[model samples]
Target: MKNLSVFSLFLVINISAVFSQNHYGKNGMVASASTYASQAGIEILKAGGNAVDAAIATTFTLAVTWPFAGNIGGGGFMVIHTENGEVTTFDFREKAPFASSKDMFLDKNGKLKSGSNHNTALAIGVPGTVAGLYDAHQKYGLIPWEKLLERAIQLAESGFPLPKSLANDFFQFAEAPEKYPEMQSFIKRDGKVVGFGEDWKQPALAETLKKIQKEGKKGFYEGEIAEALADYIQSQDGIITKEDLAQYEAIERSPIQSTFKGYQLYGMPLPSSGGVTITQMMNMWEQLEETPIIGSVQYYHILAEIMRIAFRDRAKYLGDQDFIEIPELEKLLSDEYATELLEGINFDKAGESTVTEIHSIHEGQETTHLSVMDANGMAVSMTTTLEQGYGVKMQSPDLGFLLNNEMGDFNAVPGKTTNNGQIGTPANTIEAGKRMLSSMSPFIITKNNYPFLVIGSPGGRTIINTVFQTILGTTVYDYPMAQAIEAPKIHHQWLPDRIIYEEYKMAPETLKALEAMGHEIQMRSFLGRLMGIKYNAETEFMEGAADSSSPDGGVAAY
Candidate 1:
């Protein structure tokens, strides 16, 4: 059967129709890429599920009902803080198959294959997303698993118009139909990509959801689903065997903790570069009350310099702890190290350094981030992905979930540059069962003994910069939840040292000044999505906000 392309579906979302479905006025907020997905979660909360339950429902629903960025076949990182003060980090990151080896993409001549030419089947890591969701439900979900999935299944079966955000993504990905044939059928109509307001549905995906509801995770890993996944991977020349799916498991790990201005911050540890990089940046800025004041060139310059130094360490030391040494990370984020790095910053000029050299310059690794908080105080900050837009652009008929190309995130050549413009580093090379280093940084801030802020973002290397700016927006600039999330953002990722500023809000004169001082300026089509909640412990009141640019952005309170 020929797969449909975005051009052929002629699909487009009717914004008015989607928005008219429901409202999230108060009590428990859900943020996703689309309104249907958010509504799916809000309905769960209305039906008596707690925040964790709502989040669980929303995640699964997004997997089947929204296919651009998430699915059961992908992997993700989640940070959960319970109402009673228990904090746990779930590392459901994808893992390499046992057959994988370092430099798997390198030829006998010692040349690396182009990023586009890398093996798809060989890059499929053992997916832990479904198992991780199940684990979260078992530990914290108040509703029955089947009940939660039912909502998603209903949405998948009945079908809905593609949301404007998803419609935009479909057109954006239409250029490379061969790489992402899975998106073809959904986005195409008359052999062309569909425009906005068109209807879209995945009946096969709906059936897969029903199977999961009836047979639990086994429906995905053991019976028909498992066989389908194996066959699909085999057809694609992928390395994922049935044993990989059956043996996959999600693990709970302790979050890395740090204190900034009396607020305790918790985030995922190594393998997730977010925790360390964020800690380092925060520590550098902790003493900046007298320094980077908002709207000042000195402040922005100082922060950019700090980002340069921290990113230098990030590229070298951050990786899966099981496969590498991460002991230095904790010590590196200490006050002493921060002081040493901060002292080197010059308010008058940019600092020159070698912080942008990553093992893989695989550009544009997109993901989705969501934040949930209910009246019970159960909070979850999660970021999940199919790698880039649909995981290798492949779909399995039996499983009905898009497989991730996460292995493509690593260096194909362990010690040399491949056709891509990157110098190979072994720390991030492929290895059997080893997790890839991820930039997903789901995090929370605590005031006193309770959670004060739950926040995260969805950019690859820009993750650290986006998160850093949001923290500054809330803590330094004293912006409310909405203002903090919507504030104009600026980012410098160490490589180009050129500052990329969001248009309209940033001062043009400031941009010119930075450009004169050796900053490269680039414009992004859209700002990264950031969602979070802020708690005022003194008053016992909570406020939440979602990224304004995202159509599904919203905050709820009771």
Candidate 2:
């Protein structure tokens, strides 16, 4: 494994070419929604940190620079593929508190209660970010933990220039303080929201980081911090307790393993519907009638049709592995099942839509993703979220972070599948200490026993589809990392059955072709904010791309 010193490392952070999605590095590279955080990770890589070390640092830094989804109060998944070809995943996704119930979100008539799942402190699941990062570093990190916290603590104490989008969010919350009682700590310092371009510092968050640096996970999950979290949530009608916080631990799980066209794939498994769904989709693509042509109408049609079927299975079969047994999981990932699934598809016309109207549960699109690859070839793809943007828009004045409304990810009503894309399956029903299902698909692809790509995205239900298409585009269609990342994405979760495409991104003729195929179409401003790195074996360099849809994203490499 080769290492580079900060002063000698040739860092390449080209803001000018970010729109083009072109950035490359010989030793290591990182991509994220925030240029500030990505750059900080690059500095760590240059200072001889491994990918896991840089990823940990980047996650903390995001908690500061991109608080909407980047957070210690939230939880996420991490995928790592070592240079030796071994791969594993970490599941730090939030869990239901011990006091939660299967019918907590239901009313007197057993009907879904509006806002119960996401608009209150009761929606906050016990957080796992601290435990997750600590676990990953303890296993694979080369840099010290305290060193990783330094940048984030400094960023919080000194602050950074406020980006316009973030500034606008604070302004909206500040317009009526009584409407959002807790968000004032973030933007209002003297009763005024921090204006765009001003330095916005968080003194409390810095102190929190310092505690974490000194005492590790206990700094966050025990003693003072833990007491504040439990007492505050209880005060807000939530069920979280200090016991739940202390018992929380990030799990190391086997990644969903599969192969497509000679390339090996490693994806986040179980609690996250991502790995299984993507693995199934990729395996199914191998059984397609013809090779997929990158932007053809036929290509988009095939992806949509496959996604429709896969998502149906997702609604029926996926959940926390710890809670229920998915007997057919092995069979689902089998190549034979993929071939069997193609039997129902009518590429010429369209299969009957299956939008089962039931209890609707959507993971928030505001989640953030980051990718990192150190010089030694340790590649990481991580996705973290706060359920919906500001996450219930609830924050603790003492903790200095927003709490995730992640409990919304659970099926709200049992045994009531509907046509509105609701999945009321018992597997995902609310339960004490159960991890809610997720669509995050952080993954790594390897070619000939070496790292080929590290990729993931933030688009809620669209995540699995986005990841599958990126792999298909880059590996089979021969597209570059940037082109695949910049390409318009297609998504069709089984329940919606409506084909969702990025607005104005598809060719006019292609859109018409899909419509003629009898598929209903919907338009979105964008689908996912993808951040990824693709390896070039011939040149020994890695090419990176950050989603240009979000103006603040960038790639930093050395």
Candidate 3:
């Protein structure tokens, strides 16, 4: 595998450069929401920073340029594959505050409510994103911390023309700033929401970024920024205290990985139901090697059936294992169990959506994903979030940040019966210091013992389905990354009792066939956003794709 040249890397990153037109070539690859963020990473690589360094730089810059989704105010998870073959998953998802209770969202009659009154304040979790990024950089970063943030600061100070997607998102939550006057100025204009193509600036955010760059993670966690965030929350009659801020920190967790065929799959674990569920789906899919050829009707049927089984298991048995025992996951992915479930599939018919009693809800579904691979073969698949977009719609006026609505992740139907028995089980119910369950699965695949593909997506419960389809498309159907991601995607969460399809992508005949099998179908213009990088480890050439749903998305390979 030949190493990529520095000049080649630059050509791939410069958005205005002619070389930008080509999505892939030889050097390295980066796909993110901001061109400036991507360029910052390329710059780091050119200055001798490794893949991890570039990932850190790109991630930090995103926290600024794309504040609506990715932010320093929120935290997330990252799966890093170091040059030396070390694999680690960073857990920076927000943690339940120390003052939280099991029945926080439960009402007077012990019923659950989903509105902002009980959810807005004190219910928010302590953020781990900053500490998580710092931890990754402390061990793997080559460029200085300040240097990594320079691009973000410049982008913030210069003010970017808001992209159409962000403008739309802002309009959807226009009431946010009014609810929290501290944020009224930026989110609203002339007491009204801003329109698309308008100029949006966050000097407060810029100042905050500069402060963090100057003071490091501590600046945000223990200093003025923390004080402001705490004060503002308190002022709002919320529950986050300075003590919560002080106690927050990200944890380094081992990614749950398994081999499929000859490829290795690495993903986040525990609070993240992604990796285990994905592995279970893969196991079920692997069982169909005999009859239904890949890509045939039988193939689609098998894939859909397997996914239904996996998701059924997910909806019931999976949750924040850090808080509950996800005992079924280990057994679910076990070869014997997978084979047993696979045996249950009737080759001639699509199985019932609830063939198995998998109980995992798609929680904390709002997320953004990125995939990067440098010349050194170090790859990263990361998904960051504010839970749902514009999380909680509450802004810490003094801190210049928005908190997450992760509490919405718990089961709202308290005391309902689950296949496992008892819906309001203590395992997944909100508790002080518990991390919300997540479906952000960042995965990497290896072929012939070398990195082949790094993939992930952001769509709450749909994330697992999206990743499953793409992997099967690429490995079984032999589609390229572009084709794999663009292929029609379907999802069947047991509770929904319907197979949802992407609009106009699935064949009409296929739709008829699915319907004939007693499957209800619904269509949507868009689903989750996915990005992937396929490295030809043998030749060292790579190709990457950023989701087309995101107007700001792009793939650059040097």
Candidate 4:
């Protein structure tokens, strides 16, 4: 691995064989779930663009190269650290359309309609990706918007070979191809869907990108594309309108900040629960006497307990700050609150769910993350999503992008509990033009007021815990970036009262120990796909790591 260059590893290794690879560079770095997207960002950096320019380029390129999660019709959050030391956050989360109501997913009998918000047309929300990218670029980008979009447009028009990961996604959704004819048409040839290594083209989507490059935000929100979006949605019995598209705007918000072990952590604020949850968990961990031994039963037990406590608060109080009065954030991150929560924990046993107040359902795990840093000291950590894979399984015929099922993220029926034990709460209840609650946590860490780590992930409700563990692994346990990200993870949300972990990742003895402590253990194939970059100013090198579980993830530098 040391002998091979990062780009060389990207080309020579198969997906299954590339997990251990890490990239290092002296100038700049980009880490993402797709090699193509990472390279796109590196290209911008090499061409004299700043971190924001590279991030925008990478994001657009992902829409073309990694469509399963990357999307122009979705929305997300971005945490930015400027070269001059300014920290800001941008919220481009999707909003409920004007015509949507609190009971939209409830039937005439006043019961929640089963699966109405999963893959149906009615699940679509007003998208904000286009607006968000445009706003970020306009404010901080050095290159022209057209230049940043060139690679994505070219990829869409000329086509690229389908990756195995994307092929598997197509196969998984094969049963519902007819439901998303526009997307199917792009991935199919000779009336049959293409598989891995086959050429996949999207001329229609290229045209959409061209319009965006030419007309800016209006290209997506107010003119031909918006008209097509509204028409197709209405035809499918969805209620989004052209007015909703035109009215959408991505707002810039202050990032939530906290400190642990002399490192300052900055993350997205509500409508996302990630930042607060991570801060609370870290604070609780800091109160401990010493770092728990990694991979030990005590390590898993303590982290799980902390996660349960943070998630309980997340469910009880987290919501869109613009619409609901959230608990005082500063207090939540205070040492007193963390110590108070920590005092209730029993080191030998799992605690009972003390939170009776419920919140909304969890967001889908089908989201994407990217981390970027430039030599000038600008950094970005972003996580974007379309809710579920393929979103609502529908696309606008002419616009040629998948629409987000973000409305499904809302709590459709207050007081209802799902199989996962997630209970609905009024704080996240559906409301016209209101942003839905999110678990997408994009974050950046600074040491002595300088960028130290740029990181984020896509794991729905587990995002907060995944990021928390990764940071702990790096900052407290003294693990390198690659090992920290690839290390086995454990998670426990409060209501479920079960610790879900990767099968075979934990030792049998450790499992027995946790089980003895009354932890109900559940096994899963994986937890989250994390992308991160760590900057060592002393060494003058940037180390980039992609989750071992991600199929196409890679790091690029120049």
Q: List, residue by residue over 253-349, the lDDT tens digit for candidate 2.
A: 9999899899999999999999999999998998877885556677778888899888888878889999999998999999999999998888887
Compute the lDDT of residue 321 as modeled in candidate 4.
86
Using all chains and alpha carbons, the TM-scores for the candidates as numbered come to 0.89, 0.95, 0.90, 0.95
Candidate 3: residue 297 Cα off by (Å): 3.4
**C-alpha lDDT score of every prediction, in listed order:** 0.72, 0.86, 0.72, 0.85
lDDT accuracy of residue 199 in candidate 2: 92
TM-score of 1: 0.89
Model 4 vs. true fold: TM: 0.95
- Evaluation by TM-score, superior candidate among 1 and 3: 3
Q: What's the distance in Å from true for residue 547, model 3?
A: 1.4
Best by TM-score: 2
lDDT by residue (tens digit), candidate 3, 1-558: 012222222232232222123257476788776665777777777777777777777877777666666777677889888887878888888887777777666688776555642246654667787888888889777778888887777877776777787787776666554555544655764677767776666667778888888888898889898889888877866778889889887888888988887788888886877888889888777766674443344555666777777766765676676777766667977989899888887766666644234355435456778788888778888888877766665775445566776766765455454543224534567777788777778888877655688888888878888988888877766666766676667876665567777774555666666677667788977667788888765566887777666667677666
Off by over 4 Å in 2: 1-18, 355-360
Candidate 3, after superposition: displacement of residue 424 in Å? 3.3
lDDT of 4 by residue, 218-249 (tens): 99998899999899999989999999999999
Worst 10 residues of 1 by lDDT: 1-10
Candidate 1 residue 384 Cα shift, in angstroms, is 0.5
Clashes of each: 26, 7, 14, 0
Report the backbone clash tally of model 1.
26
Evaluated against the true structure, the overall lDDT of model 3 is 0.72
